[model samples]
Target chain A: MSPLLEVRGIGKRFGSVVALAEVSTQVSAGTVTCVLGDNGAGKSTLIKILSGAHRHDGGEYLIDGDPVRLSSPRAALDLGIATVYQDLAMVPLMPVWRNFFLGSEPTKGRGPLRRLDVAHAKEVTRRELLDMGIRLRDPEQPVGTLSGGERQSVAIARAVHFGARVLILDEPTSALGVKQAGVVLRYIVRARQRGLGVIFITHNPHHAYPVGDRFLVLKRGRSIGEYGKADITVEELTRLMAGGAELEQLGHELAGYGDVTALDGPVKSEDEQP
Target chain B: MTVGQDAGGPVPAARVRGMLARPEIGALIGALVVFVFFASLSEVFRSPAGIANWLDPASTLGIMAVAVAALMIGGEFDLSAGVMTGSTAIVTGLVATRLGWNIWLAIGVSLLFAVLVGFLNGYLVMRTGLPSFIITLGSFLMLQGLNLGVTKLLTGTVLIRGLADVPGYHSASMVFASTVSVFGGAFRVSVLWWIGLTLLAVYVLRRTSFGNWVFSVGGDVRAARNVGVPVVRTKITLFVTTAVAAWLVGTITILRLTSIQANSGIGQELIYIVAAVIGGCLLTGGYGSAAGATLGALIFGMVSQGIVYVGWDADWFKFFLGAMLLVAVLTNQFVRRYAEEAKR
Candidate 1:
């Protein structure tokens, strides 16, 4: 069968500036497609196009081999494409259950007597989180009290529960510490195991390597390469993401600065001390 | 799925954190402390008669404060809410006493007028994307001017009276100003309206989907919109609700006194906000309770009169209000800090 979602040779331009060009990637069921890019490398522009916030200027965006154009983010959502941005779109002061059911809250009764089904919402939130292996002591706790990793996990679980077939996460773990990021990475794998295709976007090659089934590297608004997991290693991916030969050229240029850094002592001792 | 892993993070002070997380607990405690302190100092202050006396004003202020708290929770403010009460009162008095209209119809006209002003305030705030503070401040100034200029133009004075001479005045007063006898203490009908409205506000805030939208919009507007919450409609509705509340207070006051001053509620807006903040509403929004606002109004009523009952100079009332506000804000800040420290 066709892949769940695919974009081939996608390109975009804002006025005379080329935001993205010749980017190709595909995501199939139960797989993770990691888009690796540095700042201003067309990552956000590509995400906007994929999430239907902006229309692509060229190439084909297909779902199940059916070429289509998404008119808006709502349209993408209706087609089972959900984008969980870094902010997570949550009310931190609200309880977990309330945030979980925020936009599409369940209700009981009718007319003037109608009210939120708080009991049902709490039960579902607890059940869904439990199903995802997140056991909270109380779902009534305000979301602000949740750890950063746990908050990301909540957003992921929310997306999955909302029937998202293709999940596009924008730097989901970037704000987190090392172990916290590991916690979020585990949730990405959890989403993959549930048979949803995930487009995981990040600049960190280490974050992308362990969980990624495929990698698409972008540099300066252009795709450097796209590869299967076996075709690339984390070190190579890192170098490529940082602009391979350009990194070497920059190292050569900064060689004098490196020598001056030796006088700072800690610049030379930074690696071993940490 | 991993089992028995981190499970989020540490929640060592669960019980304390849980209580503080309610936000209204501080207001509730403060109310109780003030009640006991005043009651201990003055026998009259604790008596049923004194309770009725203070509750009368609290009831009216409570009605308005609860509505203001809802708007505050929705992340906006209606500065005109205070003057809207006066404006609505003047409208009711003018129409009933001067237009030869029935008191009921006059009340209806005032309600409609208040709603329109509210809708305008909300619409401008939403359309311009300006801060509600500035927008509502403009409305407040305009309403103040209208209250004085219109009243003067119509009656050649800044006061509207003779509502007692209007048709249906008796019936209107019976509903709004009539007293209920309970344990030898007579409470105004507005007191019941206040209590009933408070309970309703609490139910709407905690048990309804619209209430969720209010909190969501207040907490973070962009985030709420991303999640599909109707931010504009929720905020507009909150503004309209506050206006309706002002209409209620205006109607109650006019019917009872049979007259209205152009500036009766001119500066009362700040007092309503004080009551709301003291009752647990965060000026920043996204956190508060309707019950807390009502209790906040109750504290205001008790203290304003309790000072007089306990033989203190009434000049200290404003000072007492300022002091209470600071104490409440500091207490709320502390509680909020503890509530969010659960997983830190």
Candidate 2:
């Protein structure tokens, strides 16, 4: 089968500034595609292009081998392309169930009497969260109270439940602790297992390495390379992402400030220290 | 699925606590306290006739307060709501008395004007991206001026009277103004209207997708828009809802009094907002209840008249209102925090 989503030589520019140039990637069904980049590496520009927040100025974007143009976020959603941004697109003060069913609320009754199926909504929210191994004390509780990892999970589960064929997660664990990041990684794998073409965006190579089936690296506005897991190693990915030569220069510069003489004078015997 | 480890579903008691932590709970408690306090002070306060007398002002104020509460929850404000009331009242009275139009026709004309002003306020706020406080303050001043200037121009006086003899006056009054007799006490029909409006508002806020949009828009506009909550339409409708509420109260007032002063609803906008705030609405938006707003108006009704029954100075009403507003906002802050914290 053709890849679920493919962007070949996709380019975008704002006036004289080239945000993304000659970028290419493919997300196949049931596979995790990690888009690794540092800040200003055109990760956001590429995500915006895919999510229809902005239309790419060059090249072609194809889904199921059919070229499609998405003019708005709604247009992206309609095409089953759900983008969970770093912010998670959640109303902090709204209840969990309400946030769960916000855009496409399920309804009962008919005509003017049709209303949000609150009981059904709450029940499904509980079941869906439980399925994802998230145990909330109360679904009625405001989402603001949820920990950052939990909110990200909720946004992911919401996208999954709403029939997202292509899930683009923008730095899902960037704000999380190690354990929380682990939780998100598990959810990412779960989405992949459930047959979504997942685009996991993160600057953290460690977070991306374990779950990613394919890796795409971006530097400035161009693609450095795309590799299947067997073709690349984590150490190389990490060095390239940190700009190895630049980091080595900084390391040498930092070593000069260590001051061996000052350190030697600081040592003292046990009794003489007082 | 691994919840048997340690994490389990919420306990029944926790769920009960969650319910109690709703944004309106504080306002509900405040309403009960005010009711009991005033009831204890005046023997006449509990009387059926006294209840009817107090409920009259509450019905009108409650109508506007609930609308304002919804708008506040949708993350906007209408400083013009009070003057819009007066402006619509002027339109009704002038059209009926000066233009020799049927009372119903005058009411229709006034409603159209209300909607126009509402749309204008909503449009300007959305288009300019300024705070509604600024936009509606401008609307308030202009409406206030138009009310006085237009009434004087048409009626040769600041007040329009002789509406009692207008065609369709009886039927219009019967619908909007006539009183209902219960237990040998007469309560204005507006009371039922208030209750009905409150029920509708509560239902809309609680059960509908539009209600969800209101909460979403208020909580975070960018998030809501990203999720396709129709932010602009929801907010615009909320503004229109407030203006339509003003028209309703204006209709009830002019029909009951058979005349309307150009200054009829002047300065009352703050009172409606105060009532909404007293009902636990956040000034920053995203949390409130229509039922709470109605109860807030009820507290206002009780204090505004109950002071007379107990023979205290009526000037204390403003002082009491300000005090209630501060206390209510403080308590609402606690409630909002509780709502957020209870999950953990």
- Model 2 DockQ vs. reference: 0.45
lDDT minimum window of 10 residues, candidate 1 chain B: B1-10
Q: Please compute and give the TM-score of the first chain of candidate 1 against the native first chain.
A: 0.92
iRMSD (Å) of candidate 2?
A: 4.1
Docking class of 1: acceptable
Give the whole-model CA lDDT for all candidates, comma-separated.
0.89, 0.89
Give me the TM-scores of chain B across the candidates: 0.96, 0.94
Predicted complex 2: CAPRI docking category? acceptable
- Model 2 regions lying over 4 Å from their true place: A12-18, A56-60, A67-69, A258-274, B1-20, B338-344
Model 1: per-residue Cα lDDT over A52-96, one tens digit each: 999999899998889989999988888889999997788888889
lDDT by residue for model 1 (B146-199), tens: 999999999999889999999999999999889988887888999999999999
Clashing pairs in 1: none
Give i-RMS (Å) per prediction: 3.9, 4.1
Q: Kindly list the per-residue Cα lDDT of model 2 for residues A87-174, writing each as its tens digit.
A: 7788888889999999788999999899989989999999888777787656877887676777888998998889789999999998
